[model samples]
Target: MQLSEQCVLITGGARGLGHHLSLAFAREGAQVIINYHRSAQAAQALAAQLGPRQAIALQADVTDPAQVQAMLATAAGHFGRPLTTVVNNALAAFSFNGDARPKADAIGWDAFQSQFEGSVRGALNTVQAALPAMRAQRFGRVINIGTNLFQNPVVPYHDYTAAKAALLSLTRTLAGDLGPDGITVNMLSGGLLRSTDASAATPEAVFDYIAANTPLRSVTTPAEFADAALFFASPWARAVTGQNLVVDGGLVRD
Candidate 1:
């Protein structure tokens, strides 16, 4: 399906990478539902910028199935169409400062669980809630945001990397089960992004180091990574599912 024909829901669409995802999808003529747990101000401002007809902001904690279901219902009602595409981009509270992060020996299970709740459970809630509509229409797109750390582990962000790895596994399995239903699931992973709220704490030297290592000789921006997400939602990627397309400028080849 063309992106313009899809009613897209982007979780955590208010700030950071999600902000760019919302803009990119709207720019492609997709009806965007901006989901946010907190960032209400940013979310509302962004929806206003995108315009009410093209986009709307809804609040939901993606790990909670009830909230997710309600948000989806409201979105469907407001847009007069069920969501045809979902971008799982919400992240748990996290900072990208390697020095500040707990080492393997010092980190606790709570950290891993928090990330898991945000990454895995959150995706599960959204996908499960939207399944009926997706199945009914015989067309759906699940584009999960991932990280290249599973392959490169540059800073060894144990909790975050492990959670994203689980999310990737879920993406592939969902693709296999939903492919016959005309639903496609794929993951788009990127390395340390140039700058995002979560990555703002990253040391400048780390960004320079990544840029110097990548073949593109530049750190990927949220906008650049978000643009790749459109391919999965578009007809161009109908036959491509259960794949992890790394967007880290050749930093890691899988």
Candidate 2:
């Protein structure tokens, strides 16, 4: 679907990477549904910036199915149309501080479970809630945010990385199953971003290291990665699905 015809719901669209994604989609003429878990002020401000016609901020904890369902219904009501795109970008509370991360031996299943709930279960809730509308229209786009750690594992963020890996699997399987319904599912994975709430705890030296090692000689910005998400929701990617496009400036050349 063309961006102008799409209504997109971006979970956790108030801050960090989701903030940029919200802006990108709005700029492309899509009606944006900025779903925030706690950043209500930020979400509302962003919606105002995008204008009432182009965007609206809604509160929902993506991990909760009832909230997500209600949020989707409200989004459709506001736009007078069902959401044609869904971006699963809500992340659990996490800080990408390698030094502070719990070691694999010390980490409990709870850590993994939390990330799973955020990354996998959250996507599950939104996709399931939005499926009927998409199927009815015979068109949909599902974009799952992922990480490059699966291939490089540079920092070995066991809990976070493991959960994203499972999400990747879901992305591919969904692509296969949903393609027949005119829906496309894909993943956009990035390495340690230059700056985000989650990446703020990362050491400057580490950022420098990543930048120097990347083929682009720079750390990827949230805006850069967010722009790529537009492709998965656009007509250019109509025939593309079950794919993982790494947006870390060629850091992991798989």
Give the whole-model CA lDDT for all candidates, comma-separated. 0.95, 0.94
lDDT of 1 at 85: 95
Q: Give the range of the ten consecutive residues with the poorest summed lDDT in model 1.
A: 148-157
Model 2, 1-254: lDDT tens per residue? 78998999999999999999999999999999999999999999999999999999999999999999999988888899988999999999999999998887899999999999999999999999999999999999999999999999978699999999999999999998999999999999999887999999999999999999999999999999999999999999999999999999989998
Off by over 4 Å in 1: none
Candidate 1 lDDT, tens digit per residue, 58-127? Answer: 9999999999999999998999988899999999999999999999889999999999999999999999
Clashes of 1: 0
Candidate 2 yields a Cα-based lDDT of: 0.94
Write down the RMSD of all candidates, one decimal each.
0.6, 0.6
